[model samples]
Every structure is written in C-alpha cells, then in structure tokens.
Target: MTEASREVGVVLRRRPVDNPWIDHLWSPAMILDEVPATAPWTVLSTQADATIYYAGPASIELFSSDTANYRDNLADGEPRIWVALRRQDGGSELELTKVTVDPTEGEAMFESGCDVIGTVPMPPEIAAWIAAFVDEFHVERVFHKRKRDRAPGDRRGIPDEGKRRT
Candidate 1:
C-alpha cells in the first residue's frame, strides 16, 4: 500500500507524565501563545503523547495543509495544531489531541489532557527564546495516567525511550 493508504483515518494515542521533556518545548509557547494560523505539518507517529520529544530537533513543523481532518472532522472549524500519539506497543489505534493556537499566550494548550501536557510549535526564529525559557525556569515534575489500549494497528513499535535497542 502507498503511504497515503497506510494512514487512512488513523489517530495517535497519548499518556501523561510530569517530567516530560516537552514541558520545556511547550512552556514558552504558552507565554506568547504563538500559534501558527496557517502552515503545513508533518505528523510523526510515535508511542504515546509524552514521546513527542523523541521526534528529535525540529521534529515539530508548521502545518501547511489540513491533514485529512484528523481532529474528529473539526479541522475546518477553527483549525488548531494536532498531534498523534500512540502506545509503546505496535498497536494500530492512537489518540488525536488538539492545542488551540492562543495568539495572546504564545503557547498552545493540550486540550485533551490539558492537565498533563501542553505543547508549543513555533517557528525557528524563536529558538533563542525557547532556550532561555528552559534555562530560566526549573522543570516541574508531573505524573501522567496510562492510556488504555485501543484497536490494534495504531502503534508502529516506535520506542519512546531515549535509545532504540534491537
């Protein structure tokens, strides 16, 4: 099957954790609420929401087009940034979380599990600010609830831990 056919109507899954590396990435985003009104995106299917950090440097990009309305057919209605998360296991089911681009706050809130994780996807120009935020603020510790397994096939066996052992 082609790449498009491989990703038909699929969603990623997410869990919560207090010591998420993403805390650094999303915090500054919240300060300015720098939500991209319009841009293209490349979805990196990973194991759970917390694993987003593993997507590596510059893994997060602007969404240039609507990604097949992955947000419960709400992509067209007040579009927001969407990320896919899945379990560590190679399951076929996942969760779709939306973060509203707060033009005022400079960050996006993870609406699904707002209490757990908030992410900020910003342009590269703001890289320096993001760095300072990390250096200035002490990373808070958090605990996230484990998500139940959905239908199989949503996960792609992507390791969330720092290293990928064979």
Candidate 2:
C-alpha cells in the first residue's frame, strides 16, 4: 500500500419494505463511510445520504479462486467492478462483502444474500487505480485442466496363476 492509498469503507443501509406481493424484501443502499482524501477525486453526485464520488489513485484486490466464473471477465477483456454489500443476522455492521469484476461470481454473491450495491464503471481514474494494484499484485494464474481417466479395460481381476477354475 502506498502513502496515497487509503481504504475507503463502503457502508450499506438496509430498510424494510412491506409489499403485498413480496413476503420479505429489504431495500439496500450504499454510501462511503468516509470520502477519500486525495487528488483528482471529487464528489460527483449525491442521493439522499449516499454519495457517489470520483475515486483517485488507489489500490484494490480481487478474490482469488480457480473457478472460471471468477476469471472470465479478466480473461475476456477489461473487467467491470462490482461492489457487494452484506449484513449478517440483521446486524449493524455493514460488510463490504466482495469486490469482483466477474459478473457470474457477483451474481452468485447477490443470490447468496450479498446485495450488489453498485457496479462502478471503469473510468480512466478508476481504471488507473485498479491497474496500479493489478500491475503490482495480480499474477497470471494457470488453471488446472482435468484429464479424463481411462475406463477399466477388464472387469475381472487377473486369475491366480495356480488357482483352479470353478
């Protein structure tokens, strides 16, 4: 981590929704716990209490996995940024669940109770931030390719050399 990099926490707010059609649904919203104090980053938009601010040069890390769903975006082309928010047992602690560039993996997290609060587009500033981190840390990983096992050629075991046939 560089002196210019700061860990900006994502805070999630959950409010109950009472709908006749849906049994239980909670609307999730996100806001930065604190705005990053850096250059080239400014508050672009603000809704109610959530503020969408432009991020300056920073560092971010993606989760590591062998699943294709996690690597497809990185392999295909430029990856998209998805910020996941999750709360446990209706707790107050808002967790920044996962920061991923893979759509499939992000969807899976959403389905598993992690609300995708925002999908940040890779603007030049954001892209450069991610690029710096990736350049320093992201390494090309070789996937393990599974080979098909050979079928059992003979069902019966080799007969004992001296055993008599029944």
Candidate 3:
C-alpha cells in the first residue's frame, strides 16, 4: 500500500441520546469501555474541537474481526461508523472508512463512500495525539439508523401540464 493509502485502526463509540433519530442509529452497549472522564488533556489533544454527533469519545482504535461483532448484529439501514482524518496540512481530508462491525480477514464487507461529516481541518500532531489515546476492545450490539421522514407537503409549486388551473 502506498503511504497515503496506508491503514490505521480506530474505534467509534456511539454517543448517548434522547433523540429518536440519533438513538435509532446506534447502540451504546457496543462500547468497549467507558473512558475515564478525568483525562481531559489527553482527550482534548487527540480529539481537539472536532465536531462529533455522538455524546461520547467519538473515534477510537480498530482491533480484531471480533472486536466490533456487536455492529454485525445491528439491523440493516442504521448509520454505519465513519472516521475522518485531517491531512498533514490544513485541509480537512478524510483518510479512512469502515463499518463499526468486524469483518473476517481478507473479506471486503465494509464499503465507505466519500462523504465528509465535518469541514474543519485537523493538524497531524492533533490527529496523532488523539490516535494514541484510544483503547481497543471486543464487543457487539445491534445499532440503528434513523429512517428519513417526508416533509409536510409537496415542495413543487408548479402543477403538472394537465393539472394547470387555467
């Protein structure tokens, strides 16, 4: 693999929730462990001021196939785990992607498209600092993703040719 295409491991713990939408998208039981709240400097240095939707420590380290077995059991259509890494420079570039579930080695189960969840640029030092702080563990749980709901009415103002009022 080229230097830019290299892979690093990371874990994403879903944030706690009261919103039905957010709650449906993830399962908290899958978390490997609760990071101690006292390590602010470590947490701050790594995560920085990144925008994470979930309430907990957002990104973590990726381990073995069985590490995220909980994600495998999750029902279809939930928002899968996504990780974004800032480029060495100031650009907000997403370097890697994976599902929260563990896949068998050599098996191509997870596929991530290029959708950036955030816009801020993260420095390498900050990214590296965060990378060092996460701990890895094995666990699984069924997570959910909120389905899209339709708006109150049709947005199209102009009627079809046959339906014109005149």
Candidate 4:
C-alpha cells in the first residue's frame, strides 16, 4: 500500500516487571499497519500488545459498542488493545484481513510471523493518513437505551396447620 493510503500507529508495551526502578511503564515498539488512529488513546496495560498514537486534534467518530465482547474481555481479566487491519491491491476495495489482538480474527497474519522493527513516535504524515481513514470510515452510532421491566408484586401469607392429618 502507498504511504498516503496506509493507516498507521504505534504499538506499545510496558517494560516487564523484572526491574526495580522502571522510569516509564509503557514504550512504543512497533508500527501498526491497519488500525486507524482516531481518538487520543490512553496508555493502557494490554496483556497482549497495546497501541498509542496522536489522533490529530479532531473530533473522533465511534461505532456501537460490542457489549458482549467487552464484558467477556473484562471477565477474562486480560486487557488487550484491538487492532484491525485492511489490505487493498491496486484499485480494489480495502479488505479487512487481520486483527492482532484477536487470535481467531488474525490467524493468517499471525502465522506469517511478522517482527517488530523498533519503537518510534507516531509520524505526522502517518498520523494524517490514519486521520483520513478514520474520517472516511468511522461512523457515529446512537446509543440505544434499554427499558427495565417491573416485577410482579405478590403479598400473600399461608396459615400454619395446628395438627398433622393422618
């Protein structure tokens, strides 16, 4: 993919907790090829790989939350950063092919054995490219509120029998 069309960001991780005095918890390590840098992401401790990038000082659009997946991830107690990647050849449409955080989603990409080159700050050009992709693809979804049902009220008392019947 051309540099102008590529969506990029930095994948970061914390220094393993083996040292006594760690200056910084997180450090950028690799460039993400597919995920769009939309909003200013907070530094998180992803048990897997985490990403942080300059989302340009523009408004970010978001989609509907995957509640089930979110709950499952929370229940699993292993935090992760979800990275989605797409590939387009020549003039063909962009096809989503990988997600590093999801094993099943990016099985093929994982099997390819990609390596991390090194850490670097998010480049301005790459940030702009990701911003463009986010502007084009990210859609604003309305949050739907669910109504709660009222429980039925039952107020009845049973009389105790004085003697047992034969």
lDDT of each: 0.31, 0.48, 0.32, 0.37
RMSD of each: 24.2, 8.3, 19.6, 15.1
- Reference-based TM-score of each model: 0.19, 0.43, 0.19, 0.27
Clashing pairs in 4: none
Off by over 4 Å in 2: 1-6, 9-34, 37-59, 63-79, 91-95, 102-104, 115-118, 133-147, 154-166
Clashes of each: 35, 0, 13, 0
| Clash count (model 3, backbone only) | 13
Q: Using alpha carbons, what is the TM-score of model 2?
A: 0.43
lDDT by residue (1-166, candidate 4, tens digit) is: 1212234454445444556664334434445444554544444344543334332222212222323332333344443333332334533222222322222332444445432112233344444544454455445558899965555653234345585656
Worst-scoring 10-residue span by lDDT in model 2? 24-33
| Candidate 1: worst-modelled 10 consecutive residues by lDDT | 1-10
Q: Cα lDDT for residue 94, model 4?
A: 26
Model 4 CA lDDT for position 61: 22
- Put the candidates in TM-score order, highest first: 2, 4, 3, 1
Higher-lDDT candidate of 1 and 4 = 4
Write the residue-wise lDDT of candidate 1 on 1-166 in tens digits.
Answer: 1111111121122345576453322211221224333222224344554322222111222121322222222223433333333323444322233332222221334333333343334333343333333344424446799987767755556556677667
In model 4, the number of clashes is 0
Better of 1 and 2 by lDDT: 2
Per-residue lDDT, model 4, residue 47, is 52
